[model samples]
Target: MPQSELGPLKSRTPSSERAVPAQELRCGRRLSGWVLAALCAALLGCQPARADVCPSKDIRNNVTNLQTLENCTVIEGHLKILLMFKTKPEHFRGLTFPKLRVVTDYLLLFRVYGLESLSDLFPNLTVIRGNNLFFNYALVVFEMLQLREVGLHSLMNITRGAVRIEKNPELCYLSTLDWSKILDSVEDNYIVANKNDRECGDVCPGAPRGETLCPTTTLNGHFSERCWTQKFCQKKRCDATTQFGEVRVFAPFALV
Candidate 1:
């Protein structure tokens, strides 16, 4: 990706030397990595062109063969389904989905990438059974007023999305949404700070022991170091012992 100094719309390189070495590219004259990815997405027509009918194969089938779903949305509308594995679905740069309005259930769904703040898109969505977001950076920024359940593991699991948890150190509250059921078993994974930013070391917390960076999540949010630790640090009263990495647990807030 090229680094644009002017704006979002103008950091493209010349078509010649398309395979030029990225490091060798002239600074201030190339697009940033993010911009480059977006350009490729545009050139390849990665986003959906039209609403293709979703195949009726089991959702799990598509999970193993993401190659088949390069041009369609997953399950849409009112339905009850069971997902039972950890699968990383590919996200087309300009993917779109149908407006969901259903009282559905996604039980035992292991991991998902693009299902960000879905509550806003599906006002009637209720009862999301056993599942973990794992990583969907855009979801961290979603406004799911009714979302009460999330099952994210480590920060590494969250590969992309927009909630901006990257710089927020005091961010412990993963979601402001309210769901009837949410599992809190992921109180032992390390959370990653703003690893993408150059100034991250100054604002972000020190990395877990033995590691040079914080635990990984879908690291796109602009959260502070305090906000990140405070939100996910476990609140259990156990024998405090220094562990190898940052603990993924939350304690009650006390302004000390």
Candidate 2:
């Protein structure tokens, strides 16, 4: 997890790493991955002394233990893919880890039934690091009944906690995601009862001549014709002439 380049006070340790500031304090609001490493460790005041050891058992084997986490890039603990028995859903086509980008803690998928798309299974998962949370949810996709598009599009981040994607009945873009751009604060986040957006007739590559980059959600605030498909878009959607690997080299906006 030391590919570095994480600006503004970098903080992502797990290879015999140490330091803690009461589990990175966590106040709230739109920052970005590791929240700039816990705000670069609280503006150099540095904190966090412990926390990271809670996966005693929970990977319910299949797909060869998820292909042995394909040389994990950082998964210190808690990545439960619970209670399996004759796993289906194409057994996760081309199941990939391709170098996971950090789980640090919390990322469960209960009743996982033939997954649909995590883009390419954790496609360079951005970050889950709730440090450790299940009851408080760091990212729980419950009852994945033939899940549709969670397509993690290089997941933005979930630093502290909150997010309980419940009863995935053919999950869709979850309203083109706008969890305050990726939670900093906002509890009770139970992205409730999936499967609705007009029965998932989602269509996007460009929302009808609008040159798609997907990210438009407004209910009481108007505009909601819903059509975010390009694998359900994410952060800016990258730039430059897209023609690369790992889904257009992490630019927070690169999936064209």
Question: Which candidate tops TM-score?
Answer: 2
The residue-by-residue lDDT of candidate 1 on 223-251, one tens digit each, is 23221231232121111111221111111
How many clashing residue pairs, candidate 2? 11
lDDT (0 to 1) per candidate: 0.25, 0.57
How far off is residue 102 in model 1, in Å?
Answer: 0.5
Worst 10 residues of 1 by lDDT: 247-256
| Candidate 2 Cα misplacement greater than 4 A, ranges | 1-56, 61-76, 86-104, 108-111, 114-157, 160-169, 184-196, 201-256
Model 1 local distance difference test score: 0.25
Cα lDDT of model 2 by residue, 45-107, tens digit: 554322222232357747567766666555667777765667887788877875665565678
Q: CA shift at 58, candidate 2, in angstroms?
A: 2.3
